[model samples]
Target: MAWIHLLIASIFEVVFALGTNATDGFTKFWPSVVTLVAAAAGVYFLSLALRTLDVSVGYTIWTGVGSVGTVTLGTIIFDEELNAGKVLAFVLIIGGVLGLKLADRKSGTTQPAEPEPAPVSV
Candidate 1:
């Protein structure tokens, strides 16, 4: 469930990023309005996941995934300039996100770790 919210947050980040790019320095009214709304939603869900997740870890994955998604979106949607360098950097970001997911699983953050029983004294 929390992971689902994280995914939602990532998608909202992409939407908000694209909205901002279209806003033209924030002077544009409608795009700016839309951007703000999307941004609010993005941050809200991000905060929701933080309830069960660590700040540094959650933020690392949330923002990393969002950043990579936004760039890929720009390339496909707006036909933006996507040179090899940019693609390589995006791939690195993706790899970093995957590594974090693996770490989360191993650390038992993705699932509740087993509880330790209290020791009995004689």
Candidate 2:
């Protein structure tokens, strides 16, 4: 559930980023409103995820997701640069996110397995 919230929040981050760009330095009213709403939602979801996940790991992933998504969106929507180095950076960011998830899972932080009780002799 927390992971789901995080994923949604990450996507909202992208929306917020684009909304801000469209706002044109706050000169645009509707885009600014949309940007504010999306930013709020993104923070809300991030808070939800933080309730269960470690702050260090969760926050890092949150920012990474947002950054990667924003860069990709910029390239596609804004015709921003998409050089090989940028592509490589995107791959590295995604790999790091996956690594963090795996690390958390390995640490039994995501969902813990129940421990067996000690045998009791009468």
Candidate 3:
């Protein structure tokens, strides 16, 4: 469930990034509105996912996936460059995200356990 929330957040992050480009320096009202709304939603969902997932793992995956989505979509929508270097970088980012997820699953701890309370001196 937390992973699902993180995926939603990453989608929103991509939407927010692409929408920002359409905002025309925020002069375009509708695009600016969309960008702002997407940004808010992304953060909201991310916070929800963090309740169960470790921040280091969750946040890294969020940004990594979001970046790949943004670049991939940007090229198709805006006719931006998609060079081999960018493709290679995307592959690495995706590998890292997958590795983190696998590590988390194997460890059986999505988040860090709470520290034990110290004994109080009488």
Per-prediction TM-score, please?
Answer: 0.82, 0.87, 0.90
Q: Rank the candidates by TM-score, best first.
A: 3, 2, 1
Each model's lDDT comes to 0.84, 0.90, 0.95
lDDT of 2 by residue, 6-79 (tens): 99899999999999999999999999999999999999999888877887778889999999999989999999
Top-TM-score candidate index:
3
Misplaced by over 4 Å in model 3 are: 112-122
Tens-place lDDT digits, model 3, residues 1-122: 89999999999999999999999999999999999999999999999899889899999999999999999999999999999999999999999999999998998877654578999999
- Stretches of model 1 off by over 4 angstroms after superposition: 110-122
For model 3 the TM-score comes to: 0.90
Clashes in candidate 2: how many?
0
Per-residue lDDT for 30-65 in model 1, tens only? 999999999999899998877766677778888888
For every model shown, the clashing-pair count is 0, 0, 0
Evaluated against the true structure, the overall lDDT of model 3 is: 0.95
Spell out the clash pairs found in candidate 2: none
Name the candidate that leads on lDDT.
3
